[model samples]
Target chain A: MLKHLTAAIALLATPLAAQDFSEGSQARSWNLYAEIPAKFEAKVVDLVCEFTGDCPADCGAGKRQMGLLRTADDVLILAMKNSQPAFTGAAVELQPYCNQVITVDGLMLDDPDLGARNVYLVQSIVPPGETDKIKANTWTKVWAKEHPEAKGKGPWFRRDPSIKEIIATEGYLGLGLEIDEAFIAENF
Target chain B: MRHFTLSLLAGLALSSPGLAAEGTRIQVSGEIIDTWCYYSGVMGGPDAVVGSAHHTCALWCSAGGIPVGLLAEDGTVYMVLKVGDDTQTAGGDTLLRMAAHTVEADGMLYERDGLRYIVVSDVVSDLDITNKNHEDYGNVPGFSIPDPNK
Candidate 1:
């Protein structure tokens, strides 16, 4: 599975860039992503509920995995991420649209090797009859509200006090202070 | 240009009538890894980001919505689509619970564009974070954990 992906796609305009194709062992054209561009209409559904009948009233309240049940092919495309510089899932954005049909404009990635046929990264979404496209940035808003203290000039992860606290308490190796100290002594 | 390929996940077929991703069933064992950091070379080299040292960050990354990849024993990252009763792949709660843990799973495999995808039917056994590489490489990137000093 690791062999199937490369960091080459990280050079895209958006932090969401996913793949790169190096042809003939020489430098070739750089693509938008290792994914396909996709746009379509679908009903938003919680994947767990859709697959296991464990339907929640709020689709896990943006905490569960949300998918778009495509109207075109009835395909359940996992709406993987939002259009954020840092990694953010699309759950928050799509949860509100649960069971409601909406138009999606985004990128699609699939891995047949692991059986994930088509995974989606939503760049934008459109509610029924709405001409304007909603950028898949809902997670950012939620993050800001949740971590107003984390607001800063860099990626949210770096400024996130919660993450910083975790790292500080656990140490970078995630080992308690003792093991980390031993590792420090052994290495430096 | 984006290439159109056939998608076949285990236990997960396109609900489309008479149409579905034709996947092959198989049993595989490996560690659930963060494909973004592993491939992106962000947190550290591939070796630094697996097993115990990377476990904490792995949970954070998975929760953050980076696609979860199963770093197989042979060093392959099988992109996990759906596993067992989990409704969604990647950032799903179940995937979060399984973060960095190694497991032997029965599932279907599909290949397209030189990539492998999986839809796990059953997780036979979970080894639970067995890589334990922090002894060799301490907290790779040294950033996954913040510096208490600073």
Candidate 2:
């Protein structure tokens, strides 16, 4: 109870200290898989520079993995993926915010056991007192623009030409035509 | 000197949901695999998805932001969050290079959601794609090899 109270106080105080990410909250009811709705302040940084001191401008031009240098405890939390259906990374959304401290709204996937301390899935960027929210949806928009001919109603991965070609060439089992044929003939 | 405090830089307990102030150091040997395809089973069953067969596809997945997994000898898949010097959960150059290769790793292992995740500090030794299953599966998903004519 004291822990929960402290966390509640931390939430209200906003001193930018160690956030008890695991303290009971609304994320407990989030429908998304293992997502804890997170709204925290941090400075976005390029992981490459953080790791190897190889600092490139523009956060490696959204090519390198970006992480949040949490204002509290100075913990670096990786924003692994965005709120896209496919495993589209959070780079595009976080690129512009690089080297800047800002308030972010997203889902924090925590797996203490796996040591996935704070792998955030950025949904929208909402800086403090800012009404304009930057939503993480650049990937699909770019995909739609690029694949004009194959544009349709479905997940992008399914209609992906390369994936379709691969599946067609190797069959669903990915074990060559002969094996797939034999397996299907016997099983189905 | 810990760039990312992912659980523990050396050995410190993290919080609940990731680690509860207790960390485990592990030395595991396994094949680096595309976790997305492995779990999704889109290409094939578990058997055909690893080794020399899935190398090309694995590379594509790694580049396309699908985090790679270390399929240990003990049949446990550990999500390779950050590797050696190249920090990043996924889509890093190191991950792309390590794709489909078998290696021995020493790192902090975290057990969560009945799965495993590791931020490897050192890739002890890389065996360099030694599975040799391509002969059996013959380029698991043939489209992975782009057509020269195109």
Candidate 3:
């Protein structure tokens, strides 16, 4: 009887042990510049829908916002971040997996501006029962074909006329607060 | 016994290095602006403008779940984070209501990667309640003149 009670007690303690392990592992993975490669099998969800339970048809397409409802803890949502300009990185790859359960491989980025929110910069996504298919960043190709004049011209923002106007009037120094000038000058 | 073990684990997690508070309580006075517009310089001009003119747009963007940031008088932009216990109420809720108005907020400030975040506890608007803009008075002919009889 004592042995059985010991076994039962150990079974009850298992979850707590697992939780502690996860917390420690996650804490160690919180470096900003370091890209911690991670794999997660989760449901692709729109943040608005996941939080409000009001799923939209296009899944907030123009916003390019998507998150992963981690299978291990459904309550925890890993918001995906775009690594490229014009929301063309993970946003483009995760577009096909909306509202579907899929496996995603990515680098976890700790974004200070987002407060406690951590971003998953997705590298590739695989549908259930399918082999891993590398993400080729097809959106970049499409963007290049559409804007042939933009080739080697610099980042999209540099080529943007509206941004050019702001730069011309404000100078790059005027983009932030006047106080930020010293910091910007030192950094950039 | 199970409950005790779980509680202990929770305590340890909360007291962990990254989760523990290395900051002190601070009072910051600033204008609440939507972070997207402030950082991206897209919709609004790059310089953080706080006035009645920008209030409507700031409220709209903040209400749409954009992160609200406080551009303090000291020129520090603080990303308002929800207080630990108050998960339901976003930090933007109060900021949205007081958009474009100067407010003094009491909060615990945490810093990481040259960015600052404040988990606000209290907010007090600096704008006078009785002060009315000319637009609020509407078009009135010769209303500027005081009554001579009084």
Candidate 4:
């Protein structure tokens, strides 16, 4: 009886200890530049659409894009260029996140033409500096305000990336805002 | 109403063309007989140069004389002077109508249909809102407003 009780106690205490460990570690600290209260964080996303024409069923020609901002810890700019496969009739999209950062794990189709290796897992860490810039820069703010559906409540919130499957993987395409290879090699 | 203001402005133009500001100014200058929309050639691009892209231009008349379009030295076509918004009322003297003119207007100078023409910048109705003009309005012909020193 004591052995069973001890096992149950260990199992229950494991999650609590893990939670305590996360709170004590530096990994738990994150800043997702939002207008929320100081104790709470908000989510900001940027959706970009490129006006690529039609393509084959397997290609990512006519598809929308979605990106999110994870908390402040990791500054990852994840771009899901194609929300739906080719022939979906959706427009090519480009989303830029200014004041928010996000972490996501899913399938990302890589394109060699642009020299970028799309990723299934991306984590963006938007700093406080970027948030201030977005607020002050009238051009960036105007674009964000015009497209409320991209940030507001829409089908985008429910469209989750299927992390269970890996469709295809390749090298980075060297697209828009990406990590510098030289900087990564020197630092990471 | 427009005639009264324009005549008053034209009288000012011939009297005080000398008191106009120096750097990139939008003023009406000329002697008593010839009135022209005056602007200076700014060097830098819109982003680099200050007050390089902003200016206000307008046509004026004392009586019923139609305004003429202002032609550049190369005859490349410059200001299309018109009374009010209608071009037919203009005196074919594209120089008399008022519009915002840019100096380095290479962006708008495109070879379309085998003809070369440069488009001026946006037209501003209220120059007083800007604070860049430093000349006293009492001496200058026409009403010249300064740019905002923000």
Candidate 5:
């Protein structure tokens, strides 16, 4: 009976030991699609600086790409998707904390393509003293409200003559359309 | 003899880094879309292409230095990048000008993490834009059609 109890205790203790030693094992177990509450404390670095030694003064002034360098794991997490429209969401919130060690709390997103690279969509961010707040899509919303005339009128080349001229001379291909080579050869 | 020849051909195709490194030249048909609006469903859903309806918004986004993407016919979105000699450059003014139009792009194809990318070398407008698969945003709220009578 004593031997049986010892065997059972050993089995229970083995899993506990493994759990404690395995780094990020619990964090990695979260479902990729689920909204996982995540907090990353790291230095904000511009992705462009990784290749070109040109680290911007203010993380590209929120006009260029930015990412988070998780010092704990030595992984660079690309924090923003695009720089156009002055950026939105986490990109905007993290702009002020550029090159500084800050703690950000948000829902971790598993980008299908960049999943292995630890890319996440930040929902909210917090600096040293502040509490967490939702990251708003401010730029896009403002643009949508301001440009009422822009509604439903798209493929701007058809409406604007100046745009057409730009496309013709500058060789700006409209959208990603597969052109018929035969037709091009015959027409122009 | 036939089996041996097939094996040799397979080996050459697999082992040739030069062929893979340079990438395969392909001409793909698709709609040029702004990545942000398309993925986040901000302007519309994922099917939203840069069309006459969404041209203004797309132009605004593209002009602001957004990375352009090609939504191909086969349902693959290629993150369009510039083809440079040594390194890939950001999509420049040319991409902004082409914001939302059905176009055919000729370029080198690359795949990473199940996502496709085309380093655009050349592009042409598909004159028959109506035939392409584009999500139509028909006269949504806050947009007015121009008066041809005026």
Candidate 6:
């Protein structure tokens, strides 16, 4: 799913700089993370591993069991034990990938010296159904429909063809509003 | 050029504000793991040549070749020298082609919603690990087996 940004819709230009973990320290180490209490299991399910990609057979050599847990704030902690991807220092570590949730025993990132390790410990199991706080398809489609001109040459923003096909084929109209048809015809 | 790539990512963030925050935006950059220039989706789809067999590619890469991308539980990163769905590189500082089972890299980790990912701008992997370990490992039930031999 994609949504285009229009010149008219002035979005907040916030360049969230890359987070710096050099100063801070982890409250715990990756090994210590195992002590956190949570259910751990290994299963091969066809999850959209990375949103819209094929699920390979081995789940990648680093593919370990996935962890899930309901947090105190109704937020779920979904953690995995895999060789950390290439975006962090953990990638250099030689740890067998194991996707499991670690129960945080009062682990806090604010504590000095813990660093990413603190994050590892604090992040327990993630619960199901919590990830989709913002539905990707609806948001992108609606945005594109509203600003049709923002298609193609815009940011990786556009309506998902699958969703549009469903809506068009099923004859399921959203809100019965035709405010955006002309907009699409004029721009897209 | 570096600034341009960074700017592109930033611009994408503004338009698709949420993706930049969460690990939703998938940025694959690396040696082409397995190019399916005529890749047909498992079930079915346009034959635009998609890439697949990530697990097999990873395993082969571990043996001794620069395979594809590093897929972590959160996100993934690849070492791409050029950009094109069908285009491939064999081996050169600029034009390169190689497969691998292992790589060493550093990057930043990002998380959004419940997904976690790492966005890697720098990566270094050995291109000598593409062995036949793939055959040693059988396919898991109900999942597509990676064509490691490829």
Which lDDT tens digits does candidate 1 get at residues A73-159? 556676666776466777888888877899887766544433334566687788877977777787767878877777788667666
Q: How far is candidate 4 from the true structure (C-alpha RMSD, Å)?
A: 29.9
True-vs-predicted CA distance for residue B114, candidate 1, Å: 14
lDDT of 6 by residue, B18-104 (tens): 212233334433333321111112122211111221322222222211222342222233322122321122111121222322334
Task: Give the residue spans of candidate 2 off by over 4 A.
Answer: A1-18, A21-33, A127-129, A145-153, A161-177, A180-188, B1-28, B33-64, B71-150
Off by over 4 Å in 4: A1-43, A47-66, A70-73, A86-103, A109-114, A118-188, B1-150
Most accurate candidate by DockQ:
1
For residue A26, give model 1's deviation from the true position in Å.
28
> Would you estimate the TM-scores of all the predictions?
0.60, 0.56, 0.45, 0.16, 0.47, 0.21
Task: Answer with 5 or 6, whichever has the higher lDDT.
Answer: 5
The better-scoring model by DockQ among 2 and 4 is 2
Model 4: per-residue lDDT, tens digit, A72-170? Answer: 422222332122211011111222332233222222222232112212112122233453211111222332354454454323212112100110111
Better of 1 and 4 by TM-score: 1
**Residue-level error in angstroms, candidate 5, position B19:** 26
lDDT, candidate 5, B53-139, per-residue tens: 455445545544344677777766776655232121222356655566668988878553234556667775544233232224442
Candidate 1 Cα deviation (angstroms), residue B99: 3.6
Which candidate ranks first by TM-score, i.e. highest? 1
Q: iRMS value of model 5?
A: 9.0
Top-lDDT candidate index: 1
lDDT measured at residue A2 in model 2 versus the true structure, 0 to 100: 100
Cα lDDT tens digits, model 4, B1-150, are 999999999877445323211123232311111111121111112111111111211211201121122223332332221222222211123222122222222112322211222222333332211212212221122121121232
The 10-residue segment with the lowest total lDDT in model 1 chain A: A21-30
Report lDDT (CA) for all predictions: 0.67, 0.65, 0.48, 0.23, 0.49, 0.27
Q: Rank the candidates by DockQ, best first.
A: 1, 2, 5, 3, 6, 4
Query: DockQ (Cα-based) per candidate?
Result: 0.18, 0.10, 0.03, 0.01, 0.04, 0.02
Instruction: Name the regions of candidate 3 deviating beyond 4 angstroms.
Output: A1-34, A62-64, A82-89, A110-118, A136-152, A175-188, B1-150
